[model samples]
Target chain A: MTLLPGRIATVFGGRRWRSLAPLAVLIVLCILIAIANPNFIELRNLVRLANSAAVPLTLAMGLTFIILMGSIDLSVEGTLSVSAMVVVLLAANDSNGNDYGWWAVLAAIASGTIMGLISGLVQTTLRIPSFMATLGMWFIGLGLSVYMLGGSAIRLNDASIRDLALHRFLGLPLAVWVAIGAFLLAAVIQYYTRLGRHILAIGGDEDVTKLSGVNVTRVRITAFALAGFFFGISGVLAAAQLGQSHAVIGDGRLFAAVTAVVVGGTALTGGEGGVVNTLIGVLIVTVLANGMILLGISPYVQQTVQGLMIIAAVALSLDRVRLRIVK
Target chain B: MNETFSIRRIFEGKWTQGAIPLILLVGLLLIIEIAAPGFMTGETLALLFANTAVLFILATGVTFAILLGGIDLSIQAVASLASVMLAQLLPSLGFAAFPVAILSGLVFGILSGIVHVKLRVPSFVATLATGGVVTGLALWVSNGRAITIEEGGREKTAWINATIAGLPMVVLISAVIGIASFLALRYTRFGRQAIAVGAGEPAAWAAGINVDRTKIIAFAASGMLAAIAGVVLAARLSSGSPVLANQLLLPAIAAVIVGGTAITGGLGGVARTAVGALIISIVRIGMTFVGVNIFLENMVFGAVLIAAVAITIDRSKIAVIK
Candidate 1:
């Protein structure tokens, strides 16, 4: 009996260790890069790393919420792209003659939120799987963005938004602070609210949650809506960062955000992991990417490495016993 | 009473999961024929058949994976990698390297199967991981550049490009594979075991079936088929690129689903998937010929996918779609 308890303790410890594996890998990678290139330790480079990770962090936070509900949102890329394009086109000096101003930002975010809500409704009411529903949304968003932009990139001349992305305060860019704020907000909503608990319960067991009188559909729709808000904010930030917007702004964010969420110990099957894990995941990914750059790794090699990391992270985090069949 | 019972049995048999694809195919053809008078011309028909061939081949390969209740997202990546490998080895290894490249794809597929079966990871996550790795390999091997087969390579590609009595060779290959898969599923023990596993793994296991090995082989077979599709696609295109098969991922899955293959697993076969692929091809070609706006094309595709899935997915088999 003592032996069994000891073995159980060992297994528990092993799980905990695996959960922290990505963090350890990130720390080691950072140290190695610092040793290889002294410039990697510089404050400016660190800030740049933070800024680069901000968009992905925001997207990942939203994705975490969806994944926690045992659903996925593949529409993030499309929503982000469309929103980014909207921001640029509306705020473009030529397109709108610079008249939209701050309202453009608001409109851009609203567009994303609305798109999310629509996807949510389609999924909940039509009984379409979130995967397929969001995939449809992705196509719609991609098509609309392409049509609106006409394959042309729009330059943003909005001074305030530009400052928000480019200017630094408290030794960090505004985008980084925004990402941090989003992370904090996500944390609060996930832990402090009935909605968060309901979301988790839905993921744990949808039928049971419904039996408990939780408005399962409403919670799910709200989760998707929240994800859209984050995606919208991230898209606007991306436009501000580049000082331009193109349909490709959301091109690679999907994989990156999902990877971050997975790396942060979130279950893809949902009902576990949270914003704090995402924050760490975001840090690990950003640091790895920045470290690779600092170490002068080839872009192609970096892609392979990053992809491998994603696979390894997910493989490590997934609780296989819980799943009878994986689709 | 006997006659009526016999008639009902015939109706049920005829409707066995294959009706959806058949109807979709007929519907699409009718729409296209009405929309354009000469839509059935030899050239147009040939092109449509050719386009459907590769997709059909891919869907057939993916059918085995789906039959076992596991989805294979790695088909696109595997195909891409195989194509790149074929291009790289064509000069030195010539035709001899064809088998080698395909074998490499099989190896990757087996690895994916092991990862899923042994590691107990979900098929989606496992395939996603391996897909990323395969894509990375493709990118690394090709350096993101398109590789043409060169002069001598053109001869081999020509055979693939040439038609067998006015039908594309690719279509013939797809037909052969389709027939073989259909027969295998209908008669072979392997096919029955796959269906049994998908229908109820615990029951299958209790019946003393080696469920893990069956699934592994199913995935491996899927990989092999995807490789064949990739090689055929390369032969037709006359070049291999890292991104060649990126667009096929969703379409392949869509074809399988639209063919009445339950997404929850089991209860479909290769013949239905072939029809599904044909339906998708006709839709794509018809949309293009009808001058639908390119932007609206994607929306149309999505709509069609949703409609097909809604109509064909066996709701009773799926408790909840997460």
Candidate 2:
């Protein structure tokens, strides 16, 4: 009887090959939701869900790097808010005369990178824990967004940018294409780039990586910067979809990203998951959210459900034996 | 280095680590007094204390959670829920509504404790999830609007506003709680066990402490205090809304860390959080007095929060951030 338990552990725990668990969970959830509400399976609704997932997926893809490093960034919503405001004000808009064209997107992404760079610098130089440093950064970003917003939302008037939502490619919104492009780029970076592998190595064993002559400080900073760039892209995309830049542009998206990252089975303790898992996690979340709405659930209840999923995901992925302390 | 003659030697010694925030407090008072002379009058101080009293209580509670190498983000959410419940029950329950609100807080705290200890969920994530559920429940109870005390029910909550011997009742109540908590922390087994757990759970476990029970108690205390803060906040504002206390979370956490308590747990007291709360109030109102733009407050607050943690955290104790 004891051997049965030991054999089961060997199959699941020792193999280190449970990479597809989150995807399996997504498929099961989709089928269950479809049975509960047939409208969930409709092609039109699925397309809409894809469109909605694009923003969160982008945010999650950025967040994946940080989580893979065994740290967290609570500054997502704040970074999103600031970036969206900047893009709206800089683009061909009513609030400002500066229409820098595509450069506006680059500027916004650059701004996010700067914000992220500050967060990373703070983390490495001051040795402040990522949780506190990122939290403080979140506040700064939020404050800057509110300051720049000045009580009025600027409407994006450019056809090229606005067409991101109106434009469709392969039966999916242009936003989805952008998000998919982001995921592909992130995957390439994760697999092909030295910085990408370093992040996973640091998460897996920082001391060992450091002893191996890796520039841990520079790698950490670049990882955070990359994540920030993605956040900037996510925010700009959200603005494009909404056609307006408001202070609350990223008000409720932080949890969705964190939820997706964690739910994808990426260990909070660092090193076990990758961007591919995050893709499945984001899909699961997006589908669950859309399915709930179709079933006539209230938004308040939906928030609670999402919260529960976050906790459940964390609990399931927790390696209790490996955990020394939880803070 | 002149051992005894140098000012840095005397002022920045290890013995004075806990006193750093207090020293900074004095420096800030001087600045505020010089820059905003009319802002720190006796009446203004009382009002400031009144405004900060609830947060002071909440921070004091969170100090316990932080001491255990964990955090409780649900403080504001529990308080918000308690605020709504207090408003709902004020007419039928009268002043008795206070204990009920606190009880609800304790229940929520225990709920988070159960999740953290029993389910092995980390404290921050566990509390955050509970906070969402609490927020949703508060929204349902309030119907997405602020609930006010009834026509004549204001008289019942008036005690929260009343002054006793030139001190605001709110401040006085918080002081009483603060003093009691300080004594508990200084002299009680419960308090010491919590610190041990925070400093090193493995060591505490080896030393025969029930680490799990201590964590539960610590979380419950945080929840209870958060509830009390919410009830008092509703009384002060004359209304309770679902989102009323949400903004207090970061400030409360900041206050605890600013008091020289380590975010990684251990090495600070509950009383320091009360002093930390006072410092926060001065900085906030003082910034307003100095003609700073309202939009920049959050940025300044964020900077100050980071600076405070940087100053207070003992890097020697932490080998790696993760």
Candidate 3:
């Protein structure tokens, strides 16, 4: 039994093969859907698939770092909601006379960063677990968003900003392009920065990383901060796409983003995946949702499938031999 | 100086453990009374206990999981699922639906435990995923709508609202469960093993304690109790919906931590949870009484949760807080 577990761990433990499996699943899913419905591969459907994926992709990109370091951020939905409201109210909205355009978007992003920074501070300085801190942060964000919304939705009045969701370039919406840009930036950080490498090291083993003279606290905080920044961008894109904002706009995105990250083969225990994995994971999740609708499956079943996917993904990617205790 | 120093010493004494929540509860009551006179009426008191009973039950069940250095985020979702299932089962099963609802909780708890222990996923993530599945199940079963108990079914649960010696049955049931949980934790071998495991798993294993069994039992207890709470909620509301008990997760968690039970595990009990639940209930009702915006309620719970965890967490037990 011991030998069997270890062997399975090794097979799934290898980074190259681990990433490949998700890619293979994504391709298989696409082909199967195309076969089932010839229109699944049509440019419009594909564009729809990509459009649905953009927000989740951005959210997952931020979560990738946190998961990479073996921490979680349950505050994504909350952060997105708060930012969505912030961006809407600031950028020409029906509720307010303000029309700051791109500057409002920047302010909204800053709000997300501030929330992320506080979460980071709470996690590191207070010694609270990231889950608890972020969970608390989630409520705080929702409360703030709801307070701002004052019991109604805010419609975007800026045609230029709303066009981000309506206009398509290279057959993809501007929102999709923005998500791609965020992914590229994240990849650059992951593959070519000290912060990214240190995150991996910390996740591998915090004590060793600390003993090796790395500033573990700073790195962890930065990872969360970066995640918050991405959440901000996602909030902006989501609001832009819907052409309106409310406290509930960010709902269902957290599960989607986390699901994508895990489905892409990034270990929840940390140190085993990157944004590259998340990109594919986003596609997989999006394709699954899109295909579910195309095939006339209930959206309710989608949640069950995603929930099971997380458990199976985490179970399979788990590196048993490396840790003495599972908890 | 001598008297104050001795009082401080008494506060720090091991015998004084679990007293802080009680003290906080008293302090909050005093504030509420001052802010709104006649708030201490028997009717108002009854209302307070009624509100607290469901939360107390949830915290009681969750206390077992927390006592074992784990958490069951799925409890609230399980409770919702139980309520949804009970709503559907009540008409056909009459009063028999209660057990079936509670049993489903037990099964889910065991499944969560298995996933956490055998499958080796962390309890948080495992419970989270399971919670999501339970939520989906609830939505699917309820057709994403509230399921009202028919008039016939309502008669079956009417006893839940009946007064026993001037106390609501719901409040009495929660008290019984609370006392039972406290005794079980204090007297049972399994309870001792749970504490041992949470105190330190490796040492517990070395001591020949069935560590995995203890962990699984903790989660099972959590699930079952959450279901019981759900049943009571459905009884009170006369309906079950996918969203029933959706807002209770944070408060229940806050109740557990605020009761002086250490979030890191093995340092608290159901007695403490009872006190904690009272404190949380008062604070919630107190917020409404104070005219705080309903939207800010979640924010307050969030803040209180962070503050409570910070204060009660045993930093010594956790070398690394992930």
Arrange candidates by lDDT, descending: 3, 2, 1
lDDT of 2 by residue, A17-78 (tens): 45666887899999989999898889999899999999999999999999899888889988
> After superposition, which runs of candidate 3 have C-alpha atoms over 4 Å from their true positions?
A1-16, B1-17
Give stretches of model 1 more than 4 Å off. Answer: A1-15, A93-99, A157-159, B1-17
TM per model? 0.91, 0.93, 0.95
Ranking by TM-score: 3, 2, 1
**Which candidate model has the greater TM-score, 1 or 2?**
2
Q: Tell me the lDDT of model 1 at A168.
A: 87
Write the residue-wise lDDT of candidate 1 on B1-322 in tens digits: 5676673354335375567478768888888888778878998888888889889988988888888777787899899888988888888888876897788778888988877877566676677677777877888889878899898887766788888898988888888989998988889888889899888787888999888888888888888888888888888888888778877867787788788886556778887797788887877777778787666666666666665555555555657666
Runs of candidate 2 with Cα error greater than 4 angstroms are A1-18, B1-12, B36-41, B91-97
For residues A71-186, what per-residue lDDT tens digits would candidate 1 score against the true structure?
88888888998889888878755565655888989999999998899888878876767877787788778778877777677788988888878788898989989989998999
- The TM-score of candidate 1 is 0.91
Ten residues in sequence with the least summed lDDT for candidate 1 chain A:
A1-10
- For candidate 3, give the DockQ: 0.67
What lDDT score is found at residue B62 in candidate 2? 92
Look at candidate 2 and tell me the lDDT of residue A241: 96
User: For candidate 3, lDDT tens digit of each residue in A1-327?
Assistant: 254444675666555666698899999999998888888999899899889889999999999999999999999999999889989999998997999999989999999988999999999997888998999999989988998898688899888888889988988899999999999999999999999899988877889999999999999999999999999999999999999998779877888898899989888888888899999999999998899889988788787888898888777777765655666
